[model samples]
Target: MELSQEEILARLAAISQGTAVEAMKITITEAFKDRVVATMPIEDQHRQIVGYLHGGVSVLLAETVASVASVLNIDIDRQLAFGLEINANHVRPKKDGVVRAIATPLHLGRTTHVWDIKIVDEQERLICVSRCTVAVVEKPAS
Candidate 1:
């Protein structure tokens, strides 16, 4: 079931309180699916010595979205998803413009799920692409 925004916030609130763990925050500014568009505009700090966006950040955005999508089907306590593998390909680099990534569901299996992420920029240039695989784990008894 899709969680209400309030419920999502409340659940994430617990993660933020330190009793739980959540790696990424689904901010209100983020969009999803077709409406999903994100831009991490390049800054001097983000740039490499050659003046290109750090390649690591590009992969981070892709995996972050994939992990977020994987959590949609997960339970609070019993079962959680964790990354098993991630493969990223850097097609090109941009030093001045914004960088964005979009994740699409590649497969959702009983025990595994995969997502194909495509990263682009404000000018609609391909930056990086990645595939993330997550494994579903059944937690031990409390």
Candidate 2:
């Protein structure tokens, strides 16, 4: 069964309270089969020395949304999802403004999944584009 949106948001909230996500101030806004969305506010901690939002922070947001969406598609009792590869292209730079990331599946397979993530500033200008590949593995024996 697919996870409810509330459950997904709760999971994201829990994750954001953890190490890196908390530092980046990421909050998941929406999640479902077709799309997963998150937002991160621009803060001093999220900026590069020159004041632009850090590229790695964009990639982190992309990977987080893509990975969560892929994991949501799997049957947790039998399989687990792990990110295999990811690539990001930073398009525009922003010094201040919240950024939102939207992730959509390019492919959803039995053993692998591919997702495309787009990060945009509050004005909707593209900031980064990312792709993530996830591998579905059988659950390990406890």
Candidate whose TM-score is highest: 2
lDDT of 1 by residue, 1-142 (tens): 7666567556544654532123322232243432233446676766678888777767666766676667765664788788888989989878776677777778888788788888887777788989989787888787
Q: Which 10 consecutive positions of candidate 1 have the poorest summed lDDT?
A: 19-28
TM-score of each candidate structure, all chains considered together: 0.73, 0.91
Model 1 regions more than 4 Å off = 5-37
What is the C-alpha lDDT profile of model 2 across 85-142, one tens digit per residue? 9999998989998999999999999999999999998878999999999899999999
In candidate 1, position 136 carries an lDDT of 77
Q: Return the top candidate by lDDT.
A: 2
Model 1, C-alpha of 33: deviation from truth (Å): 8.0
